[model samples]
Target chain A: MKVMVAGGAGFIGSHLIDALLAQGDDVVCVDNFFIGTRENIAHLHGNPHFKFYEQDLTDLDRMLKIFQAEQVEYVFHLAANSDIQASAQNPMIEYKNTYSTTFILLECMRLCGVKKLFFASTSAVYGEQMGVEVSEDAVALKPISYYGGAKLGSEGIISSFAYMNDMSVLVFRFPNVIGPRLTHGVIFDFVKRLKADPTHLRILGDGTQSKPYIYVMDLVDAIMRFKDVEKGITLYNVGVETQTSVTRIAEIVCEKMGLPEIPFEYTGGRGGWKGDVPVFAYNLDKIHAAGWRASMTSDEAVAKTVEMVL
Target chain B: MKVMVAGGAGFIGSHLIDALLAQGDDVVCVDNFFIGTRENIAHLHGNPHFKFYEQDLTDLDRMLKIFQAEQVEYVFHLAANSDIQASAQNPMIEYKNTYSTTFILLECMRLCGVKKLFFASTSAVYGEQMGVEVSEDAVALKPISYYGGAKLGSEGIISSFAYMNDMSVLVFRFPNVIGPRLTHGVIFDFVKRLKADPTHLRILGDGTQSKPYIYVMDLVDAIMRFKDVEKGITLYNVGVETQTSVTRIAEIVCEKMGLPEIPFEYTGGRGGWKGDVPVFAYNLDKIHAAGWRASMTSDEAVAKTVEMVL
Candidate 1:
């Protein structure tokens, strides 16, 4: 089978591409490198089954040409404006990159007769659910940030398109994913900050912000495990059961960086930024019921990510 | 209070404007006249309390200028592509008229600090939830039409904007709304078709497709009752509990037009159109709990709409 990864040069996308190539599936990687880096997919330069396109998914005509040319059977739509805080400052970024990209891709897919899709959604859609495990089916998805809103918008569009066009869509609502080729996150931020000033670390929020962090490979494996789901709009929450705190992450990063005695200073608040979701926990019952579980815990994933970045 | 009613010359918007003007509020009406007509708001030309601007809500700069000039204290965002079937034919119609309008309006509101908003959402956002009364709170919103998807997207964006900018938003998920100045829907379609050929009436679905139809005045009343809600994101299912069938609607239209013995021909399917939702029921528990109710039932609303249109 042939597949196209929409954001297949960035952190998780690159990892997904490698896994697909290893499994002997023809892979087409498309990325404009807005948040994605060329270095991530640098190792796959001369592979036989791997093709790459540095193109923006928001351009409908270009995406249509690619879809027509490749005869792409399936699409892994992981493309989005990944930076939540950056989107909070300039909402047009999320509207154009995140929401419009999904709109254009769905239109292109419909036009080209593609019938299957794998969408990477974020748990940010379940905004500020405070003090309960958010399941896939329950809880009204009221995203606090522009980024979350855009993702939720994309999900609605994808759902409608799937139903209207007789297409099958697999939407995975992911928590914070951590591992190698880490571009952005609290882990990456901490690593960069500590590298600059090992004596003091400035954390964004009050150290109590806690959430689950799934490993990149584990997430990729979960996506691979459910690749052949020929259902109409199958949604799942993919993450480990356990959670790690901000303070715990700080401690792990310090230990991993060999700077155990670094002083920690916090810009005090419940949330790190204006649109930040202070805390959330995913109810992974749906994905777990599917017989797929993350191999690493939140702490374990954070620790390994720290080592990889360091 | 000074309020701006977007799409103020359309069906429900005209009714809302009349209500607002009757209650001694300064009304600034903005519309591009896409589906809206001059006849709807012709009576308001000499009224000093009501001001009309023929402009598109999708233009950000113009909307911002209007916001600054009118000092619009609250916004009743009713602007959208009212024709769902037309949107199914061209998805970009909803993208530009429905979804982008909301995005631009919210941004203008945010910039001008005009916090309060009353967004007109729909039951289409609920999609095909078979055999159960869908409340405003429960059920994952998987809209099956481009129109529904755009409305749901607007809801998500409005929720986030309300949360992020400390604004109060009142989102009403309306069922089929009927009565005077009815631009589109089954009743309007039946009346128009029967006028063209009084001997025969053509219905879209199996004629068994049923859903609640709220009267426009009653819906306007509900919106007025909750206009001052200072809460963060107050959502309500605004509709009558009773449902009217498509065949029943056709019969009503024929009777009103003095052609009661007209032959009924159905296109024969669960849905009238490809993205059409066959059946849905709204749980009015939330709106009832908030001390509001629709005065007219579905059958009465449909019958009355037939009379009005004829």
Candidate 2:
């Protein structure tokens, strides 16, 4: 099948493209490189089955033309401004990159008569559900950050489009995904910070913040596992059931970089920054019932990500 | 107190403005008059307490100037394209009127340091939950129409703004609101159709489509009752618990028009239009528990609206 990945030059998207190509599927990759980087997709320079477009998904006319030209059957919408702290300063980043992008993509799909879609939503949509293991069907979705709000808004838009246009949509609410080619997160930030200063490390918040972290391959596997399900609108929470703490991640990074004796300077707070939910968990009963689970735990994922990035 | 009522020249908005003025509050009304009319607020021409701006809410620059100039203490955001069928035909109408307008208004409020807000949401956000009375805290919000989707998106935006800016927001998910200045709905359409041809009345759907109809004044009363609740984010279903059928509404309109023997021509379908949820109900338990309730029933509101319009 011919597929289009909206953020195909980014970390997760690049890996997804590699998997799609290995499976002998023609992949049309589109990205504006706002959060995505060309280096991620540099390996696929001249692959016959891969096509690349340096285009903004929010531009409906151009996207429509690509859909018409490519005759793309499926869409994996992963393009978004993933930086939560930056969006806290200016909410328009989330509005444009996350919310409006989804609207424009859905409109393009509707106009082009494309029906199949896989949207990359976030667990941030659950907001500060600290102790509760939030399910796909959790009663209230009150997002704290602009990014989370935009993702939630995008999901609402996708749901309406699915019902109105008879489209089959699969939405995955992902937790912290970590692996090779990781662009940005705690692990990446820790590694970068440690390299800048070997003896002292600055931590944003109290080191007690913990959450699940799934490997990128595990997430890609989960997507491929249930991509064929032709449901009107099916949502799943994708993540490892286990969690790893920020301090634990710091230890893993220090050990990997041969700097285990580095002192950890803490910025005491419940959250790392404004609009941060310190901790949350996903209830994976629905996805587990569907016969797909992550092969690595959060700690293992974090450790491996440290090893690869270092 | 000084308050800004967006879309203040429209049906429900005009009534809200009147109530605000009666309560001795200075009112700043803004409307582009797309769905609103000049006649709705023509009587307030000489009232010093009332100020009007022929402005579009989506223009952030102009709205910022309006907010700064008005020094608005509170905002009652009733601006949206309420026409569901029209939005179904063109989804951008909802995206622009409902979703983008809310984002701009919230941004304006943030910039101007105006905290309190009252938003007019819709039960369509609950989607097609047949026979189930959906509460504000319903587990899954899967809107079926473009209008509902956009409204739901707006709610998500509002939630984020409330959290990040420490603002208080009151979101009221309104059902079918009918009253004297009503511009559209089944009752209004039925009256218009009967007037166009007294011998033949064309009713959309099977005419068995039943839902709650809250009178404009009753809805306004509910808003005024809970507007001062300075909660971070409080959502309420503002509607009468009782419901009325479309056929019953047609009968009521005919009787009110003194043409009770008019033939009712039914366009048979589950929903009146493509994106219509044939039947649903609002769970008002939360609002009722909060010591507030609608003074009118759905049937009574419908009957009264018919009598007044005729």
Candidate 3:
């Protein structure tokens, strides 16, 4: 199988690329290096089955050329302006990088006869869930930030194309995915803050805001498992079943770093930033029914992530 | 006041131009005439207060040039590929017209120092509603169609601009607005179909899909009334509070045309084409509290729209 991993140098994408290569699949890693870094994919440089292309997904012609040349079979579209907080500030950048780029990639895939896609969506698409456990089917997707809006927009486009063009799309709404090679995330931010000053870690908003977390490797595994599902537009929540609070994550960071219980300073109240989903957990029964489940809990995932980042 | 009405030659925009001109405001009507007809705004061509410019909003330089030359004070962004069903079939065109154009417009507005804007959003942004009444405060803005997604994308950009810059934005999530000068709606489609074949009318889906309909005049009134609201980013559900079924609308269309009861044919069993929201209704309590409400009932709005189109 020939697989194209868009944003393959980013945190989750790099992990997925490694797994794909291990599974004997030929991989074409494409990245614009906006948020993605070369260091993430540098290990796979000399591999026989792995190839890399530095290109922006927003450029339709460049993407089309790559798609045709590679004869790509499956596309794991993870490239995006993944910062939810920044989207609330520079939304045009988010829309262009995330939504427009996704649209362009889909168009290129359709033109090149690629039929299968693994789209990395987010739980932020559910906005603020009313219930404690959010299901892919139950939650109405009202995204507060531009990032969520772009993901939902990309989902809608993919669904439309799937129905109209006989394309198979598996959309995974991932929770807070944390692990190594991550450029931006709550755990990464906390680690960086702690490294800068050992006294007190400045936490945005109140520390009571809670959310589910999934390890990057676990999310990548779930995505790969669900890629070839025989559904036209199958959507799944890829995350651990349990919820973890922000304060717990902070404490886990301190514990993992072998630092004295660092005093946490809450800058203010509410979520981390504007358009942040403060509290939500996912009902993983849909994906678990498919014989797939996360091995680590949210706290365990956060602790492991802190250990890796620290 | 100098107001720029993008897509001013089309349906609701033409009506808005009239209202603005009647208020002694200079109107710069910008449109590419894709669906907008010159016949719609033909009357105001020679009026000293009204000027027309044919240009695509995606062309940033062209738009900026017009903004600088016209010295526009306020903007009424009505330009978009308005058809939702068509957008599902052709998502890229819709995105380019609706989402990309909005980004360009916002950039141009920022460059020109224009602060006030009245953006025409849609109820489709709500996607499939959980209950009979949907409100602006309700989360889960899952727009099922590319059209809705594009509108939501535009809202995201506008909201971000409002928060980041000193801009006042009023976003009106209009329901099925229909009336005189309306180019497209269920009422207009039904009338056009019945005129071609009065004995047999082809209705999409089961014809039981219900939606709130607002007269164009009422929508314009609501927008004008809320234009000066001091909020940085304000959103309102602008629609006739009563819900009307498509079957009811068909009956009203037949009666208005003085035709025999037409045999309605359901093309398969979908309320609309793929990506169409089968049922939706808005909670107008917020807008009603804002000292404005739709005067016409949904049925009345449908009937009056049929009369006008016929």
Candidate 4:
């Protein structure tokens, strides 16, 4: 199978490329190097099945040209604005990065007769839930952050294309996916902050702001092993079963870094930022029912991620 | 109260202006005059409390300037690309008109310290449903048409802004809103097509596509009498309780227009166009629970609209 992984040089995308190549699928990795880097996918240089294309996904003509020229059969759309904090500063960044990119890709796919799509949606699409865990089919989807709004917007766009254009789509609402080659998020921030000054660590929200975390490998595995049913839109919340807290993560990071009793200064709030959904979690029953479960819990994932980063 | 009604020269917006002016609130009506007409709001020219601004809402700088300078308190965001068929023809039309307009409005409101928003969403957001009446909270929102996708996208953007910016918002998912000053819809199309040829009427779908319709006056009344509860995001699906079919509407139009047993020719297939939902309907229990109900049935609304058009 000839496949394209958009944003394939990024952390999770690069790992996904590895899994796809291992399965004997010829892969094309496209990245604008916004969040993704050449260093992440540099190992695949000598491989014949691996092809690298450096371009922005927002250009419809260029994207369509690539899709037609390559005769791309399947697409794993992993490219998106990874920074949640940055979105509050510029709403258009996410709108362009996530929504417009997805829109262009769907149009390109429709034009090129591509039949399948693997979309990496986020749990932030649920926004700040009243409860801990939110199921896929339950409640009106309300994405609070600018980033989440764009993501949720992209999901709607993708679903529309899937139904109207005769394509099968698998949308995985991922949790805080953390692991090696970490570009951004809580673990990376902690490591970056701690290394600069190990004596005191300042957390974004109140120490009680809790959410679920999934390892990058677990997420990659979930995508690679996704059972493609002959359906329109198949959705799953991909993450660990358990939830984790900010304090637990801070403690884990401090422990891993060999720092004793680091004074944690929290910017007291419900959310880390204006659009952050604290205490975010998703119901994992759908994915588990589909015969895919995370081997590591949220805490264990965080621990491993901390170890990997340190 | 100094209120701003975007797209106030259009069908529902003009009617909403009547209700607002009757309550003695100062209104500034903004319209790009795209689908909106001066003839619609021509009567309000002599009224001292009403002001009409001929401009597009997508202009963020201009919109923020207007909002800030006018000291706009409440906003009725109604400006959008109304034609569903045209959206599939030009996919970006709906996105730019509906989605981009809403995004710019929210940002402008936030900048101008505007606290409340009344967003006009659509049942198209629900997409094609199995059941007759889908609830506001239930059923995962999957908008199929380009217009539906854009409307759904705008709703998410509004919800996000309401939650993130300390603003109160009410999103009313309207069904086929029919009455006087009707710019374009199934009823208008039927009337126009019949006028062009009284011998035969051409229906787009299989003539069995059932959906709900609400009187524009009823919709206006609902918006005017909306109970201002202190909440971040308040949502309600506003429409008639009973369902109306396309065939029934065709019959009603022919009878009302004095056509003698016209042969109805269907274009064939479930959808009239690319994005048309065959059996689209919305549940109005949420709005009724909030102490507002439709005064007319779907059939009555259609009949009255036919008379008004004649």
What is the per-residue lDDT of model 3 for residues A140-165, given as tens digits with 9 covering 90 to 100? 45566667767776776676566556
Compare the candidates by DockQ and give the number of the best one: 2
Can you write out model 1's per-residue Cα lDDT over B27-54, one digit (the tens) per residue? 9999999999999999999999999999
Worst 10 residues of 4 chain B by lDDT: B222-231
Docking verdict class for candidate 1: medium
Q: Isolated chain A: TM-score per model?
A: 0.98, 0.98, 0.96, 0.97
Residue-by-residue lDDT tens digits, candidate 4, A98-152: 7778888888887788989999998888887787578898688888888788888
lDDT of 4 by residue, B144-178 (tens): 88878888888777777787788988888888898
Pitting candidate 2 against candidate 4, the one with the higher DockQ is: 2
Per-model CA lDDT versus the true structure: 0.89, 0.90, 0.81, 0.86
Give lDDT tens digits, candidate 1, residues A229-280: 7768889999998899999999999998889998999998888888888788
Assess candidate 3 and give its lDDT.
Answer: 0.81
Candidate 4 DockQ, CA atoms: 0.63
Regions of candidate 4 where Cα sits further than 4 Å from its true position: A45-48, B45-48, B227-229
Predicted chain A of candidate 4: TM-score: 0.97
DockQ for the candidates, in order:
0.74, 0.80, 0.22, 0.63
Please identify which of the two predictions, 1 or 3, would achieve the higher TM-score against the true structure.
Answer: 1
Q: Each prediction's interface RMSD?
A: 0.9, 0.7, 4.3, 1.3
lDDT at residue A300 of model 1 (Cα atoms): 94
For model 2 chain B, give the 10-residue run with minimal summed lDDT. B130-139
